[model samples]
Target: MTRLVAANRVISTDGKEIKPGVVELDGERVVNVSALLGERPFTEWLGGTINLQYYADEQLCAYKDGKML
Candidate 1:
């Protein structure tokens, strides 16, 4: 699986602008988006906490143990 991460702007709850500097992903699918919020180390590292993002799939791929659906 391959994924790409980039920066984008979004409107925050406080009506401020936020940036998702890095987006965590799994195999051409987005698993989480880390916004530029929270404390220094956290924000500086993974950028921010994980906020979920979704990708289009005809069927959800779920796995159990070490198998692929």
Candidate 2:
């Protein structure tokens, strides 16, 4: 299902904030992020978590036995 996440400011590709932003999310992934334009209103969940994930990553910095193997 699709959902909406509104906020005062949202992150942009240029590393800036966009006022009145609405982030469209598909499940736990972000599908779209754009400014709230015109009179398009949302009729879905306001704010909530959708299966968040968190794990450690050591790709380039992976070390074995205190040395790069």
In candidate 2, the residue pairs with backbone N, CA or C atoms under 3 Å apart (3 or more residues apart, or in different chains) clash, namely none
Q: Which residue pairs overlap in candidate 1's backbone?
A: 1-27
Tens-place lDDT per residue, model 1, 5-68, is 4344533224454475454446544444445453423222322223332225542222213232
lDDT agreement of model 1 with the native: 0.38
**Runs in model 2 lying further than 4 Å from the true structure:** 43-69
Cα displacement (angstroms), candidate 2, residue 57, comes to 9.4
TM-score of 2: 0.52
lDDT by residue (tens digit), candidate 2, 1-69: 776766555544344766666666565445666666744556342332222122244222211133221
Worst 10 residues of 1 by lDDT: 60-69
